[model samples]
Target chain A: MSNIALRKIFAMLVEKLARLEIFLEDKKETYDRPNLKFVISCEESLKEIKQDLLTIYPVLAKTFEGKVVSAEETQKALEVYKKCLDKFLELHSLSSHLPLNPIASETYIFLSDVLKIKKTFKEFDSRIVLLTQDFLTRNTHQCYTNLPFVSDIEKKPMALYLPIIENSNPLYWPILVKNIFGNIDSLKASAKKHYEELIGQKASLGQEKRKILEKIALQLTYDIYSMKLLGPAYYYLFVEAGVFRSIAETRIRYQPTLAAREQILFSELERQNFAAIAESTHKWFITLSELSDEMHSTLGFKVDFSDVQPAMDEIVARLTREAESVIPEKYLFKCSDFCVSLAGFERLKKGILVASSTIEELNKSKKQCKEALCEVNFTEKTEKLQELPNTPQQIINAGWIYSEYVYDDLLREVLKSPQLDYTPFIKHIKNNDTLLLNSVEKSRIFEILMKKEG
Target chain B: MLLNKKHIMERLVHADPDKKIFITPFINPEEQVGSVSIDLRLGTDFEIVKGFDSSSKPDFNVSAEKLEQMAVKKKVTVSADPAEPFYIQPGAFVIGYSIEHLKLPSDLLAKIAGRNSWGKIGLFVNSTAGLITPDFSGTLTFGLKNMSPEALPLYPGVRIAQIYFHQTRNSGSVKTEDAGAGTCEVISGNIEC
Candidate 1:
């Protein structure tokens, strides 16, 4: 299939996703608490929905994966996925009020992702972007984190773990994208200003430099996130995650200093953060109780979270204007006018009542009611949320779901686009094991990649 | 001999902690157990073979490059909805977790099998590190691949696989080596060996 034909299919799909994202963001005049009984009764319907999606997935993947897909086939393929959305939306309408991300959000996320990826492809079709896994793994200052990054591994092939939450959740996609792009841009600056100082960018001896870099990293993460394009859920997720990371209960791991003290370590502990997990169904609803209270305390008039679009608009309108002189001209962070937020314990109880059958399961869990789950499995897929609040408002009452399709789409697009070239940089550096070699080895590699003078 | 539904339930509802076959959220306990096995739903967390983002692409090739170290530098674990599954593209192998956390007693060992229904569609489910041993803890990881020529949508909670229990005859309990090959803790951001 020509990229053009595939792109056409994606374009139509994006249009469909935009409509759904809008629908999800649109708060109902009055919300119906999500009921598990409905999901139980509708189990067959859900299976049928999966069947319907299966019809589309293979055809859709084929069109993108080198198979011939005509205009008609593409449309038929798209119709299949769209058909599932309508069915899910009908089911999701009642539960949209709950903190759970509507199942329909998956399609919306793919649209946002493809559009963003398409934009990047346009900017650097043949550019020398950082070979991430390779760069980090090969850099003497930092080699443990990426194995495949080293293109010439003669040893047995190894599998790399790409967490779907970090990869696909549209909430994290913007920062995920920017961090890669932004870090490279930052590395270029660091290479020049501080004589290419990235070995310990986060852990440098000079606290001042480390602080500035950390602040810059955080600011860039927040700025690069397209609030307008991704929507308020991601923004709330971003804020909630930031707040969660600040609290101590999480037991986020801290790595001790490296012997050379040459580079800063970006541990997995950071991403396992509250901001990321808060997006999980179980955590979001519970976290909303406090988050809403915080917003009520700070924003004053916006109590109850009956509607947040207007307030969000006012804040963005004011901030974007004030920060206009600073933010990049081409990129603007925006949010949908979709209004949804903060359904309380009362609504939660009402939601649970619908699933009368789940009372047995909730009753089974009563012994552990007081203990809120400390470590929520990223997907909330753990059969027994051992530590989660074992109230009537458990899995059935609270929605437990997030997107999984976006990453597949992203992976497919990346594999097809192009194999990045690094022969020039590789040829310049002579030695492979450079730990014994001096700090000069680090500069040589970056200098060649950046085309800098020694 | 394989434990039947009646025997399986006995271990499941067993009062003694040492005798219990601990599986969480058994859901409809009656429905999950089959004549000789119990169904395991797909979990939300997954680890795909793909590496992290492109920007972190390192510039050099290596003979001693440890894939685990490289993976850590990149943020790349995935969580998906049961409805919107990660398509296990034909020929692509992925590690999927069972929604049920299993902790078998020393007397019981479990074997994972691809549901006959999924097998008809060319999905073969197996564990890389082999049969789940007694005393094994943590969510079970299934090696899912589409044997068919096309990409197949894999949803979480679709009882894609089934696991049957076996009672060990030996009095001496074998040390349960994790049936996973360095798969766990990918969520905690650390890849455990």
Candidate 2:
């Protein structure tokens, strides 16, 4: 393969590497996970690959005037790129969820993130194949450039130059005289060797073949060929080489920048992780709601607030721990806020329990108060009646003074006589006990009857 | 055979979209779907059998109207909405419903039983009527009896029972007939009461 062909392939590989790196950068910026070690590993490899592409750019561009560059080194660089791509694919496949096609099952909505990442990988793989084909077949049909010479003082051509090798400094001829004067035969032999090395053919005396060999020798910076300066041929080669050199240098410089543009992490896995955490969080909330109901139901009003305190504490602690474990650190604050609200729910539940106890106590106290009030009313009425006079005669006098309705008209008549004769009324009193009487009246009547009998 | 988790998941995945076999107001599938059964939760509404005059015999044999009069329907809220819970006071019996409404396919016949965890605490959960009929779509009502020495307080949304599904021989044809029959629309017709 020609040096230009190798350079073209190298450029294509660099483009793929840069794209992969960009994808990683985007992934790192957004969806990077602390849990999946492979993601971080793939990212690290991408960074190294980017550096490798930058280092190899100038090396692959260094096809001199006549000498051909071997495809061996470029193939090795391509291998590195391919390996990186393989790593990316492996990471993607390992992380992707089971494909839904074979199962013919409707996936849970939460699995959308996984499907997205799988799509990314699928697209990445297809692009890689297309790029690889472009890399392998590019610059194969045409001779892209003739090598340019380094010019110096007096506007004279000074020495032949080659672009920088990947891991080495740039190469150029300091003097063209030594090869012309000594070992000119050996220099031709060396040019013939390079022709065979690049084109896989022996050099011949035919004009076209000789011209190609001379050009190859000049590109290799063979001292004899540089010294000779064969008239129109050298000038034609130099002019041709100048156009290619300008184009190659410009291309090499621009290539890295293009690759740099696409460099950043693009990770769907992180989005998937976020979706998973959200799904789990949703489920946790539902379970917690159910558990809260059960706890409230089981111990509810019957158990004191203190009885449920530990259980509430346990649930809160468990939820926090679970959130911490599953939820990314970036989302911890939101989860904590939710947990704090859950604690608030427990506090509200506690208030309800305490209120239930308070109401029960209030009801019991109300019942006792009602019974005590009934007893107090009975005692007050009794004490008021006991305030009557001790002597039966005085009691009778008080009753006659305060009397509104007479027990009978006969009793009223007896009382009207100021209790002078009660004998007649006593027999009537014995017969008619149904007549109403105050305590004072009854005492007085009994005393009057006793006196009369005596 | 009693359906296991694998079979259950398969059915869930492939079940008809319109006639999806499901539990509504869905909780966690991991927690609800057990090896043999699905755990069901207690609902808010309850019908408590108030102590009646056992000494005097009534002339009318107990009718629907009498049953309605005999039982007190109470809805219990767990939070501060109500101060008192529906307490199944020691030696008391109450009826409660499941929070989730179930839709079973014709191929399955399910048996509802009280969870052992609650049963150990002397809470017996049973249906007054026997096994759940296929093609049934309603919240199951359970007769809850607290045989414990202490008053057992039941708040809404607790796991009181589990329904284990068993494969029935005449499931497909029976389900089609039942769904098309539309006899279940009658409130009294569907309810076991």
Candidate 3:
């Protein structure tokens, strides 16, 4: 069949399968058992078809065992595969609106797409292999080995093509004629060693010597990155380090000592702080464990709190059980002391386990309050607060109203006398008063006093 | 008439009751309200003007888009405690914004001024773009210049500027057509001079 005819048939099949999946999904809700079986059957059939197609797919590679096949035939196969890939992509996009099971569809789509990529890359690999074999056998292809910017050109033929293909370095011819025979892992290791050397040189250079170091590192990275032999880890490290270094250099240039010093200090401080926090946490855990042990000994029972960090409620339950059921009245004093002497008892008393200590503290506070209140002298000394000049400036100068007690006393006195106009007092409070009041309180006072005047 | 403390408080009590007048994280009256104006705190974002050649006149013919490329923007997060600060060196100019985003009423116009405390240290701000017209909304941008011999540390969330709100008898609209014109949008960059 013609390539176009095959592509059309493949596209139609994909479309039909997507529609069938969607139909099965819709009917699955109503006929759960039967529809599920039908869906599974359809899926299995589709899988088998996909496998059959994969098995029969002709190798588009232009060579077998060091012999070159016709270039025209290889090119025609590539064109047919390219057309099929385009149709698959179209079908994939169109099926997006179908209500297929999301997980199943995604897994299938990913699997198919990955297979396509593998097949394409395999063809690419085959082309390289053929070209390499051709270069070795034919003297005419020997000039291609003189490609510039390739390190140990005989060992890393893939690296030469990488830069031209990825970075589009026009200085070198595209390496389409051959596949590399060298192990990719060893090539990556060499490139990594090369990178380490570049960075080592960069590290030794001072601020003034950075420009040349950066230029060299960038050039080396460009060459390696174009090769595409290195994994994502190497790619990310190389790119991120280069960008970060450039930015750091720029900042160092502008601020001289300050910017560089700040960054170093920040990094050091962060490291130290994280270490300190870890140490502190470890100490705290040990302290808690020791405390728990002490409690266990005091109770004279093996509390099965093997949990490294039991919930607070669980600890409370255990403590309460020990306090109420296990301990005698004589031991109450010991438990009370534990609760009262230690901090955090105030917040933890809500659980009812620490009620005894809370009651003791409250009783003490009540007695103290009563004693203090009894000492207040209420024998009315009719000594009036000396009235100052009513002017705003004089009132501010006296600083009497600024005092919280005095302001309250004065306001009380003014309110008692109906004849006294509270305008000046109100004005002073409105303008000069810096007392912290809630919005509701401030507005209520100001609205009654200022609104009448306005 | 300049709004006094009482008037300011009264207006705030009822002002934008539903929409909140767009001031983010509003402060209580006691914290920010002054006798004559409400204090505005410094924001974290800043645009610092780079040093230029004093020999050549800056090309004014550069478009608004081009002028935006000239200034370098920096965001300096300042701690609430006054100990850590973003320093501004002598003979340096930087742009800062108020932490609060205010939406002024149609009858109320505002003016930005350096606090007396900041001005005493030879830290000048808002020499230009001081006027905030009525109906203006957004964080006000500040043109900060440190004229002191010593480097001044500016802490964000501290009182850097005061905004005196004035009530106008004539509620005429302030022209905003030319407001954002030639204004640089990005936090920092050099203009096409």
Candidate 4:
């Protein structure tokens, strides 16, 4: 095929990426995208790009398909984006503006950050897709590639685990990149090349296993792509997913001979780890909120001095009426008394390299906290280790599912009804539990609790 | 008195914290505001009864302790994913929770039922008595017994049930944990005591 489908998809991909570009209005982006034709048609005829696009199109489509973009196009766009950028860079001067699409800004940062290349573009009209997604894709077309619980739980471990710990991470670039480039810098020049390399490598696994592995690899990429729209709450859910590296005892061995009976359970340590992680997330959030409360009381139109300090406890319902402030992780608890001096507030804000929970992050993430709080993990350990069938996606999911049971029944004690106060109900619930109430439920609770203020 | 939409909205955001009705994921307030009854999404969890031995059958003569132990092993919980739904065959009964987590203030009470449209589809979300008392907080669970001959899909996340809220006289009864969580776990589909 002439890659006609791939070209059509990428052409449409511009519209989807543009949505995310809208998020980066921060850098004062005035440069408009060139025509779609100019963007995709420039190198449409390249024979080598066709194979890669065809394979990757479907994957991208699962994540990026919108009114202008189709899932098929998204998959292709994802696989083809880097290569297209490589070609674009090869053809143009370093300073030439990206002639591609609106997501050029995001892709620029995403590509550079993932490849470990340190390049900053201050004037570029760049946007990382600002819309927070469910870290797992429920907003887009649902695609479950034969993984257990893929329909409900997050699709990949790597995406789930890294969002939070990495959120406040020193290399905030990975979280900012949104897309999971996943150490892909050295895989190969292109997807087609990767396929060739895959076929050639691990020859001892046999041709059948190798082919299955390649299929799994491609599917995994789309799964990660699905999480590209992750917001801050997505990061905090690393422990909520209850699976992955933290669960040290989790053993998910490959089951080639048996059906999909993968035996996995959470040990005592994993549960403790979950509790520790949950407490950390809760502490980080409450401290952030306290800082928000402090910011609200200190700045802006406030004309009073005396009661405004003590009255803040009465007025700021989780700082919904007024809020903004984040401190580095080390100093998260320092502002325990949110009634800080403006100097102290600035001091807290300046120490933010370790603090990932900003006002924006808290707002986006709090939506999930309620749901996390309300959820009941009826997680029961299996009586015996059962062997599940060995599928490639199973292997990929097993990467985390072994650890998946990590979040079992831990948050059951946390009450659902928030202590009704001047604060909104959701904040009280967050104060109440570490398990979660889904975002919709949490927001609903927020509305319900806020009713008292009215 | 049965609270109308206006009263409901007022109570929803009542100035007094004790008088509000909290039906969350109250997804579309404007849409929900149009009617007196709040449409509730089906919750994620459903429990299917595993065939138990004759000894496992409930009898009034049996002690509550044995019944409690048997209840745990006699049923399997299935979490329905929005991507793929769980199918309930004809004449089958499954216990399910409303996706909308509700927490009524001390002064309010609620009644839950299968939505008329869902009732037509042979899915009965009727509670044992349909009455939820004051100060309840948790997903409302109800018995969803399929009366249709064909297997009916129990899709979570849709408006499967509708809840009507009411104002109580002399309210302020303290809540017992999950006093109105809407199910008797030991009794399976039995009404809460």
Candidate 5:
């Protein structure tokens, strides 16, 4: 045989073996039955074959000059390979029929090792072909008899055949029959190679081939067991099994290329940088509200000395109206108080306007507050604030003090409460038109009154 | 206005002179108190008795003597342990029965408040029935749902809630006459005697 012909034959044999490996893996993955013990044993035997193959792989590559051989002198070698293939098919079929008994499990492993040796042969020739054909035919006959077991599950009768004369696709039938024959032939060839390596004196080569065959067998057994165990509810299991089989088969066929791509993507993600923003907008608003309330009380009532009762009534009415409307609930309480202050002719009318406007301005100011409340910027200010031990206990403990400017700005805008008679403060503002009642001084007067008995 | 702990304590102890009231301090208080509201706590003892028929109210009469004994002794024992006892674990919470069986005056209304100290530890108190009717007498049951993830352990004899007395106008005879008459009619309808 020419080198090209030899190469083609070797490639065909490898393809057949690959197909068998896939079939076994699929069977193992889908296997799920009370008789999983047999599947388990078959799987273990295949695992040994797979390991043996791994060891013999480099040696096979070296012998074949990095390629499988094709030559006339290797005929006898191919015969040994055929016998190995026959034994493998027989073991698989027989194991599938019998229960997972220990004795049957040992017999399956013995056949698997015999098959492993045949897979290591480096030649494809006529003499090897004859031996392989003979063993293959014998195994196929045995497999035909075992087909009844599976056929019974399918509710099909054994030995039922349609006449060729009446067949619509007679030519297609012959081709189908030929393909089946060819598949069996390929199985025989690979089996012969597998057995040669198994029985060979070279322990390391045998070990490697054994491991590869074992893995393939175990994979098939697992698939079969899973299928039987899971019953009808094994859709997801089957999908996962399919994916695993695809990945494994792809890895075996194209090892370095696929792995390199995965490595590159992983490295890229590892070298990337990211950041996150943290801000408590709700807490800030709460603190601001508290400060506004304090400032309102401190500023004293913005009541007019003249017609105080009527003004208070009008304030109440306005508050009720505002409350009835869709204005925010927070503004409802403040609106009544603001109206009352305005009615009372109180000082700090400008402050009241600012406080009232704060509600409308809240949407815009929210953005400003979010930016200002960052922890990094406040760290220094917080340190300085902590240093100020001389501050009043109330001031130090107040939540508003933590963010003074935000609260102070809000508080400075609130109109004084109408309940306080701020006539003197009003007079001072009117007469001077410049001197305003400072918050500190107002806070003191309010503090004294708060301490006094009502 | 600006009531502190001392002021609150004094008010609770001395506010009502005509009515005799008791103030029991809970050492490891579980009730939470807010600025104005008090959160109630679940008591240690719980019972999962068979549900009573909707057609009839619970037969408190059968257990009246035992209840009286419990009230006098300030302790009651229950039979048939709960499947789980709905444990208000060390930091967990469970609903509890209030010790107070209040009879509100026609002119006044009272609201229960949770203690302030308990609120600091993140306990929450709430009740579905806020108003105490003038003729009410049974012990009030608080739905002491714990908002905190931690189990709030409680035991018998713990004061889990405080009753706040609010004074309302008498509204003279017009309001009281109608309300009192309606209640009397309902009681008469329910009891054959």
Candidate 6:
């Protein structure tokens, strides 16, 4: 048998399998027990296809045996062989449509062996599909059908389908079928649960009204930033807070009836709900703090009250000073004595004065200080500077100055160096890190640098 | 348009003998004629060089010489070899430079086409090759990508792609710069240049 003969046979087998697939798809609805019948027909067709394919295998072997050719001819032969192999594998895949049995396993092993040959073209898709089917079948018996509190689990197609889909390789048709079945089951369960909850409590509510409330609840629960439960509590707090202030402002006019008063009292009960939500927020914050602490410990940073306390104090003082400056004159007059009684007025004034200076002047001073510190090295000046409390505001100010320095100095150098390729660096920075830059600020800096270089 | 093997060989030989055109039937050329196109193969040598800055001049002669040396030695140790050369697997499409220095006549244009065999393996010659000017010189640089899932290893001197030449209406007496004849003209006024 010649290679040409084998290829013809392979093409014929593929055509036959394609026809069978179409027939199965069309007849699926007519058969009451389609699975059993489908399996039987598929098995018979697969056996015939396999026998036909095996006969062609000898023909392909004969054509390729001890053939010497020019480089160009070898290349063409490889391509032809690959095409034939792909068609052969496609025909072989009909076995998978049958029951998960010894035949399927044997077919997979035979295909894997055929793939190891130095053929130019191998059919990857057919192998991927067969592997996926085998994986699903192996895990199907382990699938759970009796989940707790979920009545009629067998009726829910998802319970039957999920294990197959999740366990199977994603490439297979069965996995796609399983996924669709599972999604339908999940949607049905969710809709049923929603209906039951809404119907029992809000019998007077229309479907649209219930739907709106449900949507609001879902939105609150799923917000990534606010962790799950805080959403509902925040919603209630917002509603109650607005009503509470309104009621406080307009008392009897708003409270028309005794029933309205009772309603207000019941809504007030949601204050406890708000507190629980706040507690959750606090817990989240605590978790964040713990993670930071672990990071610091791992990085071998010293943990002391003195190391962090002064920074906290300076931040509080800066915030207080800003608040005082923003207050209206009339409001200040009312609280003048209270403000005067507070400590650190002189320190606040000094900070305000330093912060008010032009960036150039401040930068000059900072540079001078840094130079002096470096020169003094082990001197008392360095120790004194270190002893000074570093506030969040000061840290933030330093960060802003550092970024400006980099933009003006380093980035300008980059722009001037035409031979330097900054693309990879830019790509890395853009993909991997978030720079603390406002769009306007970044654009302004970039524009200035580009103009100077251009 | 439906020229047989004999005519194709004659036309190609007469077309540009100095241009080193080789035709592989069924191999999709950069541009397909009636039924066949010549496949372009990867040249033995490639140079990955640092691009010039705004102030720097692009000297192709220097780069080409360096590429030749690298190819001869089979090793490059100077200032990070610019061109990284790799073999295109049997069914794979790898980027390579053309061996021929194609200089299209003023009234002629050329388009690169992938071979049919390559196209069958899902190897598509990208639309990088464009109108070859009348007085262009130097090898055409090709950027190849394999659309197939499997690796297609390509070798040097294999017909990997082809160029389809077309004759344009004669527009007489145009300056070289205006006609965009040379490498300098292509790079000039371009952003990267």
Q: Which candidate is the best by TM-score?
A: 4
Of the true contacts between chains A and B, what fraction does model 2 have?
0.00
lDDT of 2 by residue, A156-271 (tens): 12222112211111001111121121233454455455444543433333544344333433333321122122211121223222322222333322111111111100011122
* lDDT of candidate 5 at residue A445, scale 0 to 100: 22
Per-residue alpha-carbon lDDT of candidate 5 for residues A178-245, written as tens digits (9 for 90 to 100): 22333443434443343343334345444544444333322322222221221111211222222222
1 versus 2: better TM-score goes to: 1
How many pairs of residues collide in each model?
42, 20, 18, 38, 104, 33
Tell me candidate 1's interface RMSD: 19.5
- Mind sharing the TM-score for model 3? 0.29
lDDT: worst 10-residue window of model 2 chain A: A258-267
Question: lDDT score, residue A40, model 3?
Answer: 62
User: Could you tell me the lDDT of residue A305 within candidate 2?
Assistant: 28
Q: Which stretches of candidate 5 lie over 4 Å from their true place?
A: A1-454, B1-44, B47-86, B89-94, B100-106, B115-123, B134-138, B148-151, B174-193
lDDT digits (tens) for residues A180-249 of candidate 6 = 3234334344434443454436466555544433432232121211111112222222232222222222
**Candidate 3 Cα deviation (angstroms), residue B23:** 3.3
Report, to 2 decimal places, the DockQ of model 5: 0.02
Query: Under CAPRI classification, how is model 6 graded?
Result: incorrect
lDDT of 4 by residue, A1-454 (tens): 1132333224323322332233233223444454343333333422334444445544433323322545444434533644543443332222122222222222222222222321111111122212112222221111211122123323343445445534222223333333333323322123234444534544455555444434333422332222112211322222211111111111222211100000000111123222322332343333223322222333221122222222222222222111112112322211111111111122122221111112222222233323253232222333111111111111112112111221111111111113211122222222222112132122222232233223
Off by over 4 Å in 2: A1-454, B51-86, B171-193
lDDT of 4 by residue, B85-146 (tens): 67888998888766455667665677887788888877777875467766666667788898
Which 10 consecutive residues of model 5 chain A have the lowest summed lDDT?
A383-392
lDDT of 3 at A5: 25
Instruction: Estimate candidate 4's alpha-carbon lDDT, on a 0 to 1 scale.
Output: 0.36
lDDT of 1 by residue, A1-454 (tens): 2433334333323333333333333433235444444444345455666466445555556756677776566556535644654464455434422212222222222223223232112222112122222322232111111112224523221112124323333223333333333344443443233322332433424544444343333332332232332333433333333332222112222211111010111111122232222233233333333432332333232212113223323332333343333334433321101110111112122221111112323333222221132222122323331211111111111211211112234435433423312122122111110110111111112122122211
Best by lDDT: 1
